[model samples]
Target: MSDSKKADQKKAIVFLCDGTEEMEFTITVDVLRRAKVDVTVVGVNIAKEFALCSRGVKITPDEKFSESLSSGNYDAVVIPGGNGTASILGDHEGAKKLILEFYESKKIVAFICAGTLVAEKAGIPHKHTVTSYPAFKSELEKVYNYSEDRVVVDENVITSRGPGTTFLFALTIVEKLLNVKTVNSLKNEMLTCSSL
Candidate 1:
């Protein structure tokens, strides 16, 4: 299928691994689904059917690492931050390849908090502004045009800070893959348009 055709579906893949931050992972998936995007939560850990998140919540993967690597139909790859980000970097070549493929295809490659480290390890150069957990500021600067913004959208790469910024991060994803109109409508319906 053509890239445009793939994009029109608004399909997303939320990569998850053991130790992923639950809020960032769930919120991104929730908001994307709310925008009518088809989201697949894929697990980087092939050994586990479900991921045990940072907050102790176990998340089932809709697809395994190998499955997601072969699908290649998603329009975006969303990474949620947490302690497991290092695991994603160190352990999952499938996730890394997926990130590289998404970027090379000009599709969205987004992550939050510590997830930026995984994106960095995946070899997507950050040419424009990006953000991540404040504690990783020094580290993010090495690979990105790092900033302190709650959320940053540069090129096809999207990023946000920690768990507190997950909502805004997801809304930004919605705005990028869908439209401002959709995001506005969602924010209004969710009573967060004015609140934020």
Candidate 2:
């Protein structure tokens, strides 16, 4: 693509590992792409060919995590949550490093459900308020100012509750990274409720 063409587009990368929440992963990517964002799916610590989701669904990543980091100039980095996904990514040095890189660069770092755990694990300071899956509230609250809102955007760190809230989470990212006009167009195209 021409530099001008690329400059006209918003790019995002979604990180996935084995046991990622299927809905959160899929919905976020779908919504962002529908908004005309260029979305790349990266597999972290999983086979280059595919990653098995929490429900046993399989997905092929567009690139490996390292490859994405090396070559991608994204507006945002997204993480979709699941029980195992949180545990694995939270402990991954690469994942943590990437989160810190994005955070430091003032780029959008978005997560949903248990994926919020990765923020605390990545050693982000506790100043940013956030929200996450209810089960992780206690742990995350110790670090972030916690909220029960379906979606929380504290500066560039955007977080959300869980699978059911994935669309709103993704839409919020679209609004922040792209524009409200794009988000409004996507909501109509995706047939989402206006209030959402």
Candidate 3:
């Protein structure tokens, strides 16, 4: 494809990983790549090897956070749930800053399970509906001031519960970033899975 055609066709998605939930990160990566989105897995630390997920699976990142941030290009930022990943993202000044900047720019920001903690810590208002692991609801409720009963999508931010909702969360992000038609097609292709 030519530069203009590539630019017009590509939609960039960055997945920040540091011990993320294996299924959440892998499922999102797999589904988005299947849809032909330009997806990049960004390493949040100095380790060059694949990061180990909560389930003991290792995933190789596509690029380092330093490099991707320096490039200053991406259409969306996705965070996968894993307490370790969430804690690292919550404390990383650079990641938090970029997340806030992306949100301010009105780009899609998605988090699932414990990943929502990073968003809450980054100051995404609780008033913006959100859902996460039941154990973490109080943390989000305190910040956003709204108690969400189920999976919630507020504007460009999407949040879901735990492993049970991973597929739906991934599809929801796809639906938001691309379109409902693409999401429907993907769902139809993966007929075993239910719709969002």
Candidate 4:
């Protein structure tokens, strides 16, 4: 590939903090890459090279969060849920800023399961539709329009319930970054049960 062509390639990053949900994280990454998005799985905690997912899966990331954030060239960032999300994203100013920057720039910012709370903490508007684990449904209803539909996309933000909805959530993202045509083709190729 030519240098400019490489530079123009669509890029995405999946942020990995310690104890991220393994299934959601990997499914999102796998699907996005299948759609031909140049994906970089970045370890959010710069001090670590690997994130031990909540299911005890160790993921070595492709880049450090510091580098990805400072570079500021990705098309989007994906966040997967786990108990660690609150401490890693909800409480951390860097994570909040990174997400806010993406949203403010009109870039896609997607979350699944409890990761929706991170989007909320990062200032996702309350009017945008979203969904999360049922345990958070009540609180989420008070903030944003709650949807029981497996995947919810409102504005540039996409969210879903949990692991069961991972593929749908990922396909929704691919639709946004690329198009319905691409996602539909991908779905047929993957034999997914549904479409966006």
Candidate 5:
């Protein structure tokens, strides 16, 4: 990558924990990278080296959660949900801290599936409209205005449903960080529906 190109590239940090939904994590990363975003996958677990997904797929993150938090250059912070992903991330003070930092800094804070609960756990002030897995809609409604849209964006915060909505969630991130032009190009090449 050329120096100028690297300088212009948007960056995102994605958090991954044991039992994370594999498709949510994989599709988000793939879509972001396809849009030329520099994505750093962070393993937020004791293992530090790898995390076993809900489907038994093992993924090695690009960095450890502890080390990745200090960098404020990222354009977005993403969290993917699974069966127990919310429980795991909710208990981690570091995860909460990171989300708060990014959100308060006005950077994009995106979460999908049960991951939406993680943001609520981080103490985001209520009343911002958002969405999540149907199972978590009530819980999130307590803090957010709650939308049924496949992908909801309120200011710099973005939330979506489950694995089925991951592609749209990621494409939304690309739109926010890059442009509609980039997203349109990717959608055409990737053959995704023009839902955006």
Candidate 6:
């Protein structure tokens, strides 16, 4: 590939990590980075080591939230679900501000399971179609008027149920950001469920 083409192909994906689900965070990062997308794990705290997932997995963050993350630096932001992650996201002022800014900029913002609550709390409209963890249905129904389903893709936002839906959620984002052909190829190579 030409130099300019290579540069244009580069995309930075940030995962806002605060003890997210081990499966959701790792699977999405592993899949996207395997596709050669630049993936960064941003720590919501000041620690330089790693955050322990609910499942006892450890993830080292590339940068801290104290560092500014302008939308220009990344093509998308992903939030993985874990009660700790969701509660931190909901309570952290800076994290909430950044999420809202990213949404307002119309960049790709994705959340899975309880992570959708972070987006919803950021005031992004759920509109006609949306979904979340079945347990969150009561809260979601109270906040956003939308039809619930197994997975919900509204414009640039993608959401799914939980760890069981992690692969589908990642593939959906890949399909949306990359392409259906690429998504299919990845699925075939990995023997993952086809998103048809």
- Quick one: best TM-score, which candidate? 5
lDDT per residue, candidate 5, 1-196, as tens digits?
9999999989999888899999999999999999989999988773647898999899989977784574388889998998667888899898898888889988999989999998888877686888999998888787679999999999998999998989899999999999999999999999998875
Off by over 4 Å in 5: 46-48
Q: Which residue pairs clash within candidate 5?
A: none
Question: How well is each residue in 1-196 modelled by candidate 4, as lDDT tens digits?
Answer: 6888788777887888888898999989988988888998877763467888888888899876672473268888788888786458788777788888888888999989989989888888887999998998888898888999899888889999999999999998998888889898888988888744
Q: Relative to the unseen true structure, what is the C-alpha lDDT of residue 159 in candidate 2, on a scale of 0 to 100? A: 94
Q: How do the residues 1-196 of candidate 6 rate in per-residue lDDT, one tens digit apiece?
A: 6787777663654555546788988888877876767787777852447887787787788777764667676777888898878888878877777777777787778888888888877777757356788888788887776445656887877778888888888887777778888788888888996543
- What is the Å distance of residue 133 in model 4 from its true position? 1.1
| Estimated TM-score for each candidate | 0.90, 0.94, 0.90, 0.91, 0.95, 0.90
Span of 10 residues, lowest total lDDT, candidate 1: 63-72
lDDT of the candidates, in the order given: 0.83, 0.88, 0.77, 0.84, 0.88, 0.76
Pairs that collide in candidate 2 are none
What is candidate 1's lDDT per residue for 27-134, written digit by digit as tens? 899999999898988777635778888988988989776733643677898988997865665456767877888999989989899988887788887676788899
Comparing 4 with 6 on TM-score, the higher-scoring candidate is 4
lDDT of 1 at 7: 60
Range of the 10 consecutive residues with the lowest summed lDDT in candidate 3? 66-75
lDDT of 6 at 14: 55
The residue pairs found clashing in candidate 4 are none
Please write out the lDDT profile of model 2 over residues 93-128, one tens digit for every residue.
Answer: 987888888888889999899999999898777999
1-196 in candidate 3: lDDT tens per residue? 6787767553555555657888878888877876767887887873557787787787888777762473246677888888877988898888888788778888888888899999977877656878888889877787774445446788988888888787787787778777888888888888835636
Q: Name the weakest run of 10 consecutive residues (lDDT summed) in model 6.
A: 9-18
For candidate 1, give the lDDT of residue 126: 62
